[model samples]
Target: MLKENKYCCEDHVDMAFDDFLVEKETFPCLEKSEDSKCSYCNKKAEYVLKLPS
Candidate 1:
């Protein structure tokens, strides 16, 4: 069981979520990142992409 997570900024969350859907074959659960940074642009992450382990 591997837990996967990706932090995305508001600007790129849509694109990142789209990719996540394609990869996971289902929607990812969105959460607040708090202090996490975006994996794409390194901006302060506003969305956290997570899937069950």
Candidate 2:
């Protein structure tokens, strides 16, 4: 199943951190679409930030 990440404008500017109940093989959930729109605001994303834990 395609997990849906909870998006909060206050927490981030672009894509939100995916709260995957299951374990993922990858890290740094940040992403960008071809349209260049902010996944949270639907506006132009200033930049993409990748933070891995």
**Residue 11 shift from truth in candidate 2, angstroms:** 7.5
lDDT of 2 by residue, 1-48 (tens): 453333234335423544322334344444543335454666655444
- Measured by TM-score, the strongest candidate is 1
Query: What does candidate 1's lDDT look like per residue over 8-30, in tens digits?
Result: 99999988898888777877889
> Which candidate leads in lDDT?
1
Mark the regions of model 1 whose C-alpha exceeds 4 Å error after superposition.
1-3
Model 2 weakest lDDT span, ten residues long: 14-23
Q: Tell me the deviation in Å of residue 24 in model 2.
A: 4.9
- TM-scores of all predicted structures: 0.82, 0.30
Task: List the candidate 2 regions with Cα displacement exceeding 4 Å.
Answer: 1-11, 14-35, 49-53
For residue 13, give model 2's deviation from the true position in Å.
3.5
What local lDDT does model 2 show for residue 14? 28
